[model samples]
Target: MKTNEEKKALVKQQYSELALSADELKGKCCCGTKPMSPAKKVFTIMSEDYSKLKGYEADADLGVGCGLPTEYAGIKEGDTVIDLGSGAGNDCFIARAETGESGRIIGIDFSPQMIERARKNATKRGYTNVVFIEGDIEEMPVPDNTADVVVSNCVLNLLPEKDKIFNEIYRVLKHGGHFCISDVVLNGMFPKEFTDNASMYAGCIASAIQKEDYLSEIKKANFEDIKIERTKTVVIPDDVLKEHLDEETIEKYKKGNVGIYSITVTGKRP
Candidate 1:
């Protein structure tokens, strides 16, 4: 078995290769290597429609994120905002518009390529206040209680020890600080076929735990006023399921309540 740190390294490597280009990232589906298109819609499973949102930068979106956490982040001018899995600075740029002149935005990502790309994007747009940091989420290189808001997008579910992440989130935010995050969650562990599949784990489904359990971890870390800001079911098609299960097993799973859902939640540390 791989160590938790090893697993995280794998996740970072997968994303680094995919980060080579937006077109390459768009072609990726969780465990499967299929191009995302309107007809396929697997990216649709975990990504939100960003066309309607303002302050969009083409390179930053990268087709990442399950929900628009920045839209609900309640970022004020001059606020300090930290994005957990900044990924090309999609949310950071949006948060930048909200934070305005005196505000500062920091995006943390373990992938060196992602951090470089985000920094380049900031320069291309001449944004001096936005900074991208290369570091792991469980152990962020940030000061205590410095951020007014923390945000992430479809990234936390991949981590093994989520409670550590919550603690880190709590540690980085100032008192009365809040977080808006989007990620996938399980209704229950899906078939062993999926959980056992390496691709599935890297894709965002296999690593997911029950939604309630995820939230309970947040509460355990001493967050309050935790609430789901948005939620939607992730529809994995029959074809996708078939890639990992037999017809009999697939039918059996259908009869059960196994589901993957994407949710954006906001919580406060009081």
Candidate 2:
């Protein structure tokens, strides 16, 4: 087994590579040499629904999301949308369709590779109204009060400075702009050792904020109308679970100490 520091380093390095090469990262997931079956199933369902709309690409890219923000955000034909941590433009593309030809979508990510992939996908699909930028969400490069809706998919938990992220999101949104996202949340406190594990952090499990703490942070950022739209227990796939976690860790996960959750949290800027 790797040391704690070593695990963290490895996870950071792996995600850096993933941000640069998502196809390669997909190969390394629990499913092996293909998209994780569960992820593929989810993506396929979303792609089919999105395809019905004009100018939408059913086969946009990897399906890397824990929640559906477009549905929850009530995206309309002329609304402006921003997607934080838009991996390979999946959510951005979907939002673009919902916004229609009159609407616009901006997707931002820190990973150059992800940005490149998103750009290429946008070009291939000929989506003139959609754009993706390479930048950090914690310090968004967009102008303040420019977006009508801001959404992210399972990406907030990966940040080291989450408060700044929320603040930035608040700053950019128009008054009464919407904030909707799907991310993991911890049910209880984790052991210090597990909490500090870098691998777990990047894997979207270890870095998750407690459920109550997450809601409180949103309120602290001056958001209102907070709601948890959906909650489902996420079962760690056997393959990836065995590779990173021990029996104790596995048991903890099985007991609902750690699980995948998809919540549609909606708040408006005051």
Question: Which of the numbered candidates is closest to the native, going by highest lDDT?
Answer: 1
Candidate number achieving the greatest TM-score relative to the actual structure: 1
Each model's lDDT: 0.83, 0.71
What is the C-alpha lDDT profile of model 2 across 48-146, one tens digit per residue?
134454444534445456666667888888999999988678788778778888998999987676787788899987889999997878789999998
TM-score of each: 0.90, 0.81
Model 2 bad stretches (over 4 Å): 1-13, 19-21, 24-59, 251-260
lDDT of 1 by residue, 1-270 (tens): 668877787788767865775655553656766655432233345677776666778778777578889988999999999999898889999898898979999999999999988999999999999999999899999999989999999999988999999999999999999999999998855667557656556667778889999999999999999999888898877766666557876776777778888899999999
lDDT of 1 at 21: 52
How does model 2 score by TM-score?
Answer: 0.81
Residue 165 lDDT (model 2)? 83
**Range of the 10 consecutive residues with the lowest summed lDDT in candidate 1:** 35-44
